[model samples]
Target: MPHHPAPEETLPVIALNGPTASGKSTLAVDVALHLAAHGQPAEIVNADSMLVYRGMDIGTAKPTQAERRGVRHHLVDVLDVTEVATVADFQDRARTAIADCRRRGVVPVLVGGSALYQRAILDVFEFPGTDAAVRARWEARLADEGPEALHAELARRSPAAGAEILPGNGRRLVRALEVIDLTGSHAATLPAWTYAIPGVRAWGLELPRDVMDARIAERVDAMWEAGFVDEVRRLEAAGLRRGRTAAVAIGYAQVLRFLAGEITQDEARADTVRRTKRFARRQLGWFRRDDRIAWLAAGDPGAAATIAHDALGPDALTTDAPQQRCGGGEQAHGQRR
Candidate 1:
């Protein structure tokens, strides 16, 4: 009901958002370490969508346990691949993590490059509730008339919403239409719902287009070498299919095609590279449209940490001296297990 405090009004939840393979994870780790060295320890919360799915480690670029570097991390490997984890779900989880961190007197450092997921956690966006009948009708139409025709219809009915929903994202398009049809309001015009817990600031990481492309290519090659193909095979063996959300993760999908004999390894690698580049472009476009984020150019993790510390203040990091938890008392990472 009430509005959440703006960035300047709160304790400071630092966010590091960027495209995939732009070094957000490594940067986040470095930032956390810097905070620790300053006697202000920070906890890393995963904002990546795919990383939340269990068994998606390699392709998702999930930080290795050792790479976590004694810093507390939350929200990774929290979901089953078969389970549907929506933005709303992530909002609730991330909000809880932020609150818990702040309560403990530790700064919550949100990290990852999943634009939609990150925005869902940091900003106020209301996802339209689903209606089975409406969804079935739209899906049937989507199947019969195809995505282009359905996109056209959406454009006719809700131009603003259509502008945001890509034709290829059938689920989102249908959801938008459902919102308009059910609520008699355009999805794009939906009011921001307050998820604001005090003390949150979002930062965006950016890199030159050429550099980002090269990084993407290199990451893809590393993934392949790190048993990415076997990861896809394991998912398939677990009964995951191509059209499923988990299977559609950029690298996973392309690698799956290769393993299935649908494309050569070279073609798959090239396709993955191209898709990753396109995804990065979309990420930049999405973040650029939002004015709230404080942008930092990629490279030199220490510089990013310094910028975050400056923007958020020295208190944003929790020092080892004595820290509090969200509800009360000190809560250490891995204390639950």
Candidate 2:
């Protein structure tokens, strides 16, 4: 039997995003149920870059099966510790999941702290193809001239990209320069906040700075108690150190340093808290740049339902739910918004 695509009106996607520990997962489940009550069957597609790695449960704060509460989830635990997850790779898979859900007449809710990954999936952005030799050349330049000089060159070539990326961030600087070399301009290589995916609505959860800081501290302490160190030890034995992307995940990196005896466990935990707070701020900064996402307070219990209902419209609960489809197109780079 040939599968027909669902009507556009019936397919609405809800993207619930926020900083780490801002309760996006829990809120996503709640919103799914709320939509289900309106006859909208929904599934969650994972967007957090770190959560895709299998065996990275506690540290990544991956939702437990029980926590999922019968709602189907996609993209979680889909990668091994040794595999690298690029934004383009994630965007491809996430779009597939969203399309499949719509074909089945189900709503797709994307939930995560990775604003770039989410944008890559939801926005009309395309990553440029890479040339390994060119990349290597820039990397070599980075090594010899240091990031400052390379960053200065990038600033001269593409000031917009340079302003957005910190000079100390060599990898991004290299990628920006690479894109500029490939396309004559770097700013055009990044995604605009415009939506390419129809009927896609995004919401951001907000909390006071102090509250988020305290939450991060508490969460780090809980992870320590939940045996995050032990989890990393097991993954380390499974070649985690060689996984370019996985090795540098927030908690895992701190734990790896602790294991190397470079830092005490207490220092590692403290550093994790510090780094996480900074990361959360960065997440906020990235999402804030996009004007489309509606912001809601983190403490509000009804916020998810409100956002979901708004995205689906008043008729959503009473009418047969329609499915939404996500389409991909070519264009640009997509981190930090």
Candidate 3:
């Protein structure tokens, strides 16, 4: 049987995904502008979890208003630091934004680094059911012995799922265990690639490992210079430590440790860089598992235009940028955006 598309599902969405410092955000905006200039208006719908929180700008490397070049963006700064958001929650919000854009005859651009979160939004996925008793039991263990303990158990139950989730994410760990308990298996493991919505095209940015390492180091250095510590301090005043998810974010956690006097500022910076590098590797591995993404080598001068053209068609751009930005490469794009 032929699959007939729904009205909203027929609209196009451009997904620029990749590891940190691979420039997904910048590419997303550039694509939006290119699409608009070429007669297909587009808007950016942020797919990064951290970017959703207000007052997390510096550490998250969120694009400033000027950096966005006046492109309308959805899901940025939608939550306070004290609030928590689940994958299901984000999936709902992102789809709503995409639908709104389509309803108005505009293309929706999906941008972010977290592979799992991106999959939640774009893939045909249904989160496993949760049992209150099972959840409470795991939550109790989480509170008693800490997240790492449960993470170990999760690894035993589902190695791929465990590897995808961070050890410090107690809430996520508990949820995974609960889902496992209810269904007798964890569905967080990467499933066969399939998009929930039709006509969603994804592109990934690929950089040489050495270059990626240098970029991450430079980004961390810039963040500290840009007052990353100060940003965390400000959020701390606003109850950042109280938020389970935000409190443990890569750079935020290190800064929080420094703030608590558990480490020197230098130590925090070093730890942030090291941890971010490790995280970038994980992000790369996760995205690589999704064969649907077309990976582009980094710094292909005309790749952005090529992707814009792919989304908007031959009448897509006025510029003479080359049509091939990424082809015959490895992995999906963007790290923990």
Could you tell me how far off, in angstroms, the CA of residue 71 lies in candidate 1 after the best superposition? 1.7
Point out the worst 10-residue segment of candidate 3 by lDDT.
328-337
lDDT of 3 at 140: 95
For 126-226, candidate 1 gives per-residue lDDT tens digits of 67666889878987997798778888888999887777666655656666777778887775434453434444555667788999999989998998899
lDDT of 1: 0.72
Backbone clash count for every predicted candidate, in the order shown: 11, 7, 8
For each candidate in the order shown, give its overall lDDT on alpha carbons.
Answer: 0.72, 0.81, 0.84
How would you encode candidate 2's per-residue C-alpha lDDT over 1-337 as one tens digit per residue? 9877555445878888999889999999888888887777889999998889999999988899999998999999999999978878999999999989988888899999977788889888888878998989998998799879989999888788777766655666888888888888875546677777777777788899999999999999999999899999999999999886798788898899899999999998998898889889988998988766767788675565565566556554322322211111000001112
**1 against 2, candidate with superior lDDT:** 2
Q: Report lDDT (Cα) of residue 178, candidate 2.
A: 87
For model 1 the TM-score comes to 0.81
**Against the hidden true structure, what lDDT does model 3 obtain?**
0.84
lDDT of 1 at 255: 79
lDDT of 3 by residue, 1-337 (tens): 9999665667678787889999888888888888887787899999999999999999999999999999999999999989987888899999999999998889999999989888989998777766788889998999899989999999999997788788877888998888888887886445667888777888888898899999999999999899888999999999999987788788999999999999999999998999889888899888988777888876776776778777665455454854434353211322211
Question: How far out, in Å, is residue 328 in model 3?
Answer: 6.1
